[model samples]
Target: MTNALTFFEPTRTAGLERLRNFAPDAGRHYGERRNYLGTAKNPGAVSALSPYLRTGLVSQSEVLRTVLDQHSAKDADRYIAEVLWRSYWQGWLALRPSVWDAYQADLKRLHNAVQTQSGLRQRWENACLGQTGIAPFDAWANELAHSGYLHNHARMWFASIWVHTLELPWQLGADFFLRHLLDGCPASNTLGWKWVAGIQTIGKPYLATQENIEKFTEGRFAKVPGLATQAAPIPAPPHPDRMPLWNTGQPDPALHSGLILHEDNLNPTHVLDAAGPIAGHVTVMATADQTPWQMAPHVQAFRGQAAQNMQNLLADRIGPAGPAVTSALALKQWAQDHGFAQLVTADAPVGPTKALFDAYDRLPDAPPLVRMRAPLDADAWPLATAGFFKFRKHIPALLARLS
Candidate 1:
């Protein structure tokens, strides 16, 4: 959309009012025009709910349930299918954890290689700065840098340019997006770049053609030079020797509990059962400092919002909000000081957060750590053992259950 404001902003009531109000109509309307990009002055077509969904501001099931409550299963089928897309991606990545490892390796290799190649580095710089001669692609590059959001369709085209035209490593492209996009995700972002590189899908990679970009962008941008005339199949990297599966040991509900909020998954209300009294709440954010901290402004703002929400929610159960801290040591100290016997957090899918927590040697003698996987993901992971098509087959049944 011309206007970059998302449904996740405070001016939009941060999606609570909009979600509650538009859910009934969301099924039919969203299914029909959800892909349309509109300006900031008016963003009526799409739900504008990705940021909230990215975070746990609204639960995935709650959105599905609300849509089902309004529209019939038959009527809401398309909208319901869209909701499951995220679940499918997450499940697919979980099964193929090697994807995450290979991405990190490729990122490091490309970052180092590009530093030595002046020509390649210049092209990468131009693409990132939106100075590339490709009009539509350049516009999208600038949009992502400035807005931290892009329509899904635009994302595909932009990725195609970075990989094919600029000839940069796909992992670098994915890293650039993660460092920028507000809804920047480990699974979706990495997996998406792989798909465009012809690794996620067997042999078919998305190539950005001038005609397609012109048609989809509503004639906004037409001239994209040096476009890849044909697609090249990039063989998928061999899966890692073994994937690290999360240990699912439920902790006692009665322990003096504290919640640790990370970017892994934002919604805790669903996973963190209020079965017993919750003692205190502590919110934590790990800065994605893997690349240059270009998105520091947005990151700082999001951290503040996350801590504020956690503080507000815990005010009734606990007294005042605990301090929002950045360091793991500081967070652990807070947990220890508060006398928490158990720490609750969402399952880290795969990325820096997962890597950080995986390093047990660097951690303190913390409380019992509990990671909760969403019920949606719990159901979808089994289907994800194979391929996206097999995963796609479950979409109907998945929607039926959610409905």
Candidate 2:
């Protein structure tokens, strides 16, 4: 377990292969060993299919269906819930996108504070540089910076320590993850940090203790001292009112169409089917917009390579890809260059990709950009009106639809 975790190849083929290899252990074996962090060489039973899942490289339903084929839902329930947790977070945030808005606002203020305030800047710098003198925390910080992946259990522990012991702003900690983790998404990363800080559940905060860390990590971090002894909830406003979930947008088949690809949904089979034959496709990356600070090299490389791989995959259907762009203006140029009457893509959830499209929407007389949400997302997202416990009630129904 001493080895830093190794990342898998950033491609759909690599993702499916990982799923196939992990399928056998997706039931009791996974549930039993899932919490243990066994490093790169040793590796635990967890799937590590997140980078793939984070994008649309491999899907929730597809991952779940593969596991269910090998094991019954009764046995694989834990792993099943793990996969759907992403969907649950996305749904919760989509229902109340203002949560993301507020988080962004907080980050803007904090980002400037770090730049202008010396004491705050030093503390934050030490934490991000993995020089905090807390052995385990420093190791994890470096690991996240180097490898674009982390164990879910480790992330919870890290977030807890970041908010409680360090007493740093939770939004800043979330930004750190967004700047690094390949699986970083607006909902999961932000909501997760909030949950650790006790804001999401409102009064129930996750705290990291030396005893818990030592036990879960198999003494890899034994006697890790100087963690927060108590966790007090971070004060926050009430949850935003639930807005109606967005339905899948139907693309007009009669129009000359083009496809747009982003890190949000690279392998956009569903969108392509909806748009009919695309005259061309263009890949756009917005990972840079996800964080205020410079992103980690690993995050950029992983997402960039994955987008290119998917574009190569759909090249036959969508034709050669235009030069990948990062801004709304370039996106408009793609539409104008091809002179397609319409452009369509997979609906980006609330995050950087959405921000790019939001900017695009402001441009004068731009071609209509139809975004198609997946049947799985459109079905399951609305059900997250309450807590995950409430959402679990709909799993069987959702799985039934997947079949």
Candidate 3:
């Protein structure tokens, strides 16, 4: 059978249309059925717009606007909160960038352990290969690898099993998802796994019971055995105090500029609208920088193709666009070769793309890198200084600001 992931087209037009089609259901219908874990052939109630949203093919504001046009905030509150959760995670990590650094360090150590330790390697390999022997867990593993997506409920259950039942390292589990999930975002994926492991919220690990799985899957995974009963929180250091969000300076019209597009923010129309005309454009593929290990072939292909789709979408605005380039040296050379006085692009949140940009900024004699953050992020991220509950309290005001 063809891979179920092919159903998701990686383009702005496809993303926008998906959002439009899902908007009418964004309210009560979504609230009622969002948790059902239907198969890839039938994804039940939830909107599978995450890949688009994660890669910036479509902006959260645009999604919120579309949904709200069809339903009131009260009517669509659940869906709206779900969308804002992404921003909250991004902002939360942006403030405590050390969390991301720590995750990377931990991933490297664990990756090395998997290579050097035979028993551990066997267990990790079994889990990744979907030979775990637990039916639901094994099915989810295969589903994620085969489809590049999973239901939200399934994700929580899968993470719980990985950390508690399978007795595997949570970082390894998170890495496994990042390698496969089409919408695998740095902040959401890492922090989400951390949350399930009880590290993000501290002492509130998500426990998946057999009965809960049966309920959500509508008896499909009933009577599942070998699930852990207790979910004690993983030990972790106290969260660092929130740092100020980065101040992305306004783009200067007078300077000769080039637009740099990347996987994090594929669509640059808003950037172009704000920054005015540019001298040239360049596409940067930083998906390889997501991990030290080789990313899944599908993940790489999807991002590369999505970037190309963006280039096609913005063909009119992009002058003398160059081929897709990777690495800081290549980006610097491209900027200099095009005679660009400065480089402006969409603000990349805390992830591989941001790391790539940070490296480029530090390079000696590199042109100025001006990041243009979306107005939605500029307003929403600062409110994420606390938990989702507190951050969510401001959703109404944030939505108002978008109007």
TM-score of each: 0.87, 0.96, 0.97
Best by TM-score: 3
Q: Which ten residues in a row have the lowest lDDT in candidate 1?
A: 3-12
Candidate 1 at residue 322, lDDT? 65
Error of 2 at 288 (Å): 1.0
Candidate 1 clashing pairs? Answer: 3-40, 56-267
The C-alpha stretches of model 2 lying farther than 4 A from their native spots are 1-6, 40-42
Name the candidate, 1 or 3, with the larger TM-score value: 3
Q: Write the per-residue lDDT of candidate 2 for residues 60-139, one digit (tens) a residue.
A: 87899999999999999999998888999999999998999899888899999999999999999999889899998899
After superposition, which runs of candidate 3 have C-alpha atoms over 4 Å from their true positions?
Answer: 1-5
List lDDT for all candidates, in order.
0.68, 0.86, 0.87
lDDT of 3 by residue, 1-403 (tens): 2263486678888889888888899999999999989655577898899889988898898999999999999999999999999999998999998888888998889978988999999999999999989999999999988888899999999999999998899999989999888899999999999999988888889999988999999899888887888875577789988888776877888889999998888886678987868878888888677676878877777777788888877888877788688898899999888878889999999988888888998899998999988888888888888899999989989999999
Q: What lDDT is reached at residue 322 by model 2?
A: 86
Q: Which ten residues in a row have the lowest lDDT in candidate 3?
A: 1-10
Worst 10 residues of 2 by lDDT: 1-10
